[model samples]
Target: MREFDYERAADAAHAVATVHADPDAVFLGAGTNLVDHLKLGITAPGRLVDVSRLPFDEVTERPDGTVRVGAAVRNADLAAHPLIRARYPMLSAALLAGASPQLRNLATTGGNLLQRTRCVYFQDPTVPCNKREPGSGCSAIGGFDREHAVLGASPECIATHPSDMAVAMAALGATVRVLGADGEREIPVVDLHRLPGTAPERDTVLHHGDLITAVDLPALGWATRSTYRKVRDRASYAFALVSVAAALDLDDGVVRDARIAFGGVAHKPWRAFAAEDALRGAAATEENFGAAADAELAAARPQRQNAFKIPLARAVLVATLRDLAGQEAR
Candidate 1:
């Protein structure tokens, strides 16, 4: 709606340098999220740096039994990859469970992870949103909050990160690789995003001029046995009220390992470290799963309209674990 300058990023350094040089510049991947924000008037970047043409839209197999997904890799391509479908079914399932076919075809991997919240007030420019503008106040706190976060919410904002792919990546322990003016470095996907705290405006820890190149997933033995379950209102094209991405390693009917992350319930992907710890040496049982889910969600702070999310998240976790019972967990 507003007039803005556009620049096509020529190279990796240029992409990083461009944004760093211009504080008002944004690196565009697929224009799915950025364009939506621009149309909504939520974001008014002075310059749109088109990074979609950068050489980061690739999915390469690494020698260390890992898969490297370039930031610009389209969601559809990542979901349909033979390696992703076979070895990382959870990631593939999570990817396919999001948006629509047409949107997925244009949404890039990094863009998906960096997508903004879907909170009603945040999207509505007429309302106050601390995330959209500092000190504007959060309308969701006292307004329609049925779809807001229950866990890890802040006084400034209760919006949840809308990304199924990110939840799966957090569970899979994927490493986010970035290249900045300072050079290249890696951050765990889970750590890349932080609690809203007081800085509700800052969604991620990525510094200015830092470009997320790819996400590298190291081989975790139980990856293939993983699955993602999403509970939403109408099923298709709906955001998750609560979603679970889980992978388990069991030895002789006893739990050997587990990784669990939650979506649509927190400021970012909610990694159920408490649940994983509780399930580590416990026998795979309904009661054990229930207890683990409870432990992880025990600290959840709920508002008036969305307390149901805690139980819904617990039920999804219990069911996902049940489906894996007695199977040769990959």
Candidate 2:
């Protein structure tokens, strides 16, 4: 561990100002992911501003039915929240499918969203990874890439975003409230993460000192019938080889609306916009589901070791949609 200054912030304003003033300062929330990077020598901040005890820990349902989850809310608490489990079950399931119970107990909603790729190359300081050090060639490009990206991958990096919660939030169309030097603003969850373009080092659009206050999930009645399905090599504590977060709205066997997002396959959460467009107003059948999956995966550019992810993703999306549609019918 390296020597660093530490301060427990009194409030949000103080936290934001302290971090924004120092270029080498970072906000510490739960320190679940940040600490790991610190130990691995991936990041070294001169100062750590503790924001875990801030007032952003509540989970409230607004009058308009939007569920606002404070950034500091623990993943376990959010997963077990009555409102979350009853309404947005997909989000709850996604949270549960992530890290083990011990880690989830300390992981915060904002910290979970800020988690970087779990690519082996990105974690090892000795390896050449663009995400770890910009301009260094990506080792995963020609090396072990079973867990790498298949969609929206640039030559600079083929790493995938490793957050199951963000995938569910993307499908749910959640909004992230941020506080920065310029004051507060709202960013859609889908727009929060960036594709691995020329700037693979930047995982998200968040600039330095931008603090996530809360995530607002819009009231989508259809999401009540949604679910998150993750397929991994192991049964527990394993990241997804392919995952699907899907919601369906059916009326008399016809799909009225749908929302879909795929995980473990892209630089960010792969929002199935093409699939949603294909399923809208169409019959909610297995055949239609296949068509929708195909529409979205048509743009996939799988790498050598991860070509199987394309078919695996297609199967998971179709099966998840089918299950949701069936549940709605019952």
- In TM-score terms, which candidate is top? 2
Per-model TM-score on C-alpha atoms: 0.97, 0.98
**For model 1, how does the per-residue alpha-carbon lDDT over 196-289 read when each residue is reduced to its tens digit?**
8999889999998788899999788678889999999997899999999999898887889999999999999999999999999999988899
Kindly report which residue stretches of model 2 are placed more than 4 angstroms away from their true locations once superposed. Answer: 327-330
- Candidate 1 Cα errors over 4 Å, as ranges: 326-330
The local distance difference test score of model 2 is 0.94
* Candidate 2: Cα lDDT at 80: 100
lDDT of 2 by residue, 1-330 (tens): 689999999999999999999999999999989999999999999999999999999999999989999999999999999999999999999999998999999999999999999999999999999888999899998899999898999999999988999999999999999999999999999999999899999999998999999999999987899999999999889888999999888899999999899999998998999999999999988888989999999999988899999999988998898888773322
Q: lDDT of each model, Cα atoms only?
A: 0.91, 0.94
